[model samples]
Target: MTDATAIDTTGYLALVRRKRLYGTLLLAVFAALMASGFYVADDRNAGGFFDGLHRIFDFPAEIFSEAFQNWRNLPGLFLKFIPSLIETLNIAAVSTLFGALLAMAMALLSTRGLALWPRLTPLFRRMMDVMRAVPEIVIALVLIFLLGGGPVPAMIAIAFHTTGALGKLFSEVAENADTKPVEGLASVGGNWVQRMWFGVLPQVAPNWSSYALLRFEINIRASAILGFVGSGGIGYDLKTALQWGQGKYDQVVAIFALLFLTIMIVDHFSDRARARLVKGGRRA
Candidate 1:
């Protein structure tokens, strides 16, 4: 027994040493690859990375200098852009609402043990993977070309990406749900809709709401950028301000302030709501 125990201990130490050696080698290889890639990219650049590094703050300095000199213009610009700001928020809100609703349906349809058609689960999962894989900006650009640029196209773009993102998250949450309730409902002759509505939804609603809130915050930023590509929101206004160069820097600052304030407000409320939802915590 003593001999066998000694052999086992020796083998365990050898295995640990082998794993550590492999891990170190892997880390070294990864670092080398990253260093090589950086050098390759820098060589390919028209202006080298280190060469342009010092000038990076030039544009920010110009913008701030002009914006500060024209500080009094900020208030008017803020009031002027409020309507466009609302439009941007509208795009985000509509997209999040539609996307979350579709995500809930797709999540239920794709989740194993809860799917209405288990055989089609792979198909739905692949569909979501594709959806999530494509960037929202790519979709927005395509739709803008086809639809001639508006909030509608931006809304569709954000919603499309949101569906895939939220569907994946919602499905993950639904997968861990209590199977007992689902089983009990099905045993009572409940249809697929009934079983999911009564069993799965209740179990996952808090988590789902938290995810949706987070997505809504992200969509606001996306929609703002989409507007820059001619989607008719505050982003479009910002683009116009940028095109005007020196004279419009104050407008640019105004738009930035609005976007910053809006994101901060949304993030604050969403954090509180998620805390309350996921933990039933206090308002703070």
Candidate 2:
């Protein structure tokens, strides 16, 4: 075998010489400028910044104190908050459920390779882009203005946003699905929808279900924020508590903690369900 350690100092130095110090310096300067711009745009005072920074060290204590200050009054708080919380969940559930159904249709449209009229592809893509571009809160605010405030507006807002996001994800999944079963279905003279139903759906159904469940959890959080614009939910309670300054910061904090717990629990269950589904599918 030939020895291979023949590299020289000149070549090594030449390699090192190619390192672009000016490019790196330019990048550092660009980053610093961007950060400075962000800081200026934020308009936070130095004193307020320092105070907020100091509070981070005591955040856990602050959160705990805020949650537990009115432990005795929690039952009454719960009595008042439960109805709104239920309404929030209902809004999230109905929104995600109905939105997922609409997303299923849109998803079919998104996978242009599966569609005959390719012209519809751009239109569907643009539709999804538009829907997803508008945030749920903006949608809720607009719907509230148009339809008047109630759960309906909130539901519609959540549903539209959910459909947009879920459609995009579902289409990507569908597009990447195994084509073998689809080919078999086509060979057997099955139609497009039939091929999708039996072949594509079976392959991606588990992932789709998991995505929909995950979206439900997200919609719950969105539903909470919808109340800021009078859409009604836990957010309304939070807004009221803040506005009234009735020393109900503790109540608001407790409710928020509860919302956090609910999300965590839902995530755990959804993960378990997805795992079970994946395992069952593999076995089948």
Candidate 3:
């Protein structure tokens, strides 16, 4: 009945009082502690409590200089580089294919009602959780030790890790799929396998291929690194070149540029393929 627009002075004052003024002081203290910690951890600093500003633009001039020197030595460089590149490609291709198969199996298991063991959703999810918790590099390190440092260990590592990762992602995609076709298949007395084959696979195949191609690009990089552990690839050569020093640095840069360009080309082609797939899907 009074002024409806009037503020509730008591409530407003109580709310203002409840605001924690100490929050800003606490935040400042936390920020100061973090800054001090970062300063202490910085390598560029002298024996002071804080490190000096880091030289962020320290480029390796030696690498460029060596690369220029080796520009005329292309034939000799190719002899050392081509085998490693092929090995890397082989690792990537085999691992990606294996991972795709494993991902498909795991994805089928993850769909809520699609699997035979519908009650084992928690178990399946937990298993996937465990698999995905471990990083691919860590897995590769372990496998290298267990299986003896070779391409086999690297390929297995890539396969298992990719399976876990792609499986989880593919499972989520499968879950989000439109249920109408699945339900239709069920109404026609279709079994789980039939529904999966005729309904889910058709819809998700393009997305699955897109993801696989992306993974392949990542695999190429991983394969290169696997050589660090004696898994055999361009990374091994790169490591050798680094250790050799001076003359090899240029060659290393050249080889690295080639590897990077290869990945870029793969990415470009994959993007085009994905676009074409999407367009074709839409037209259909």
Per-candidate TM-scores read: 0.92, 0.82, 0.80
- Candidate 3, pairs of clashing residues: 66-250, 67-250
Better of 1 and 3 by TM-score: 1
Candidate 2: stretches off by over 4 Å: 1-23, 42-47, 55-69, 278-284
lDDT of 2 by residue, 1-284 (tens): 12333456666666767666667888999999998986885576555554587777574666457657767777777777888888899999999999999988888877867754567988887898888888888888888899988888999999999989999999998888888998899999999889889988888888899889889988988998898679888888878877855466677766776678778888888878877776675454
Cand. 1 Cα-lDDT = 0.94
Number of the predicted model whose TM-score against the real structure is largest:
1
Model 3 lDDT tens row, 1-284: 24543557666776776665567678899999998887666644554432222433223566766667767776677776888888888999899999998888788887786665788767777777777777667878888788877788889888887888888888887887888898999999998889889978998888888788888988888888888767888888888888887667777786777788788898898888878765675455
Alpha-carbon deviation at 92 in model 1, angstroms: 1.3
Local lDDT at 272 for model 3: 85
- Most lDDT-accurate candidate: 1
Report lDDT per candidate.
Answer: 0.94, 0.82, 0.80
Question: CA RMSD for every model?
Answer: 2.2, 3.6, 4.0
Candidate 2, poorest ten consecutive residues by summed lDDT = 1-10
As a whole number from 0 to 100, the lDDT of residue 112 in candidate 2 is: 63
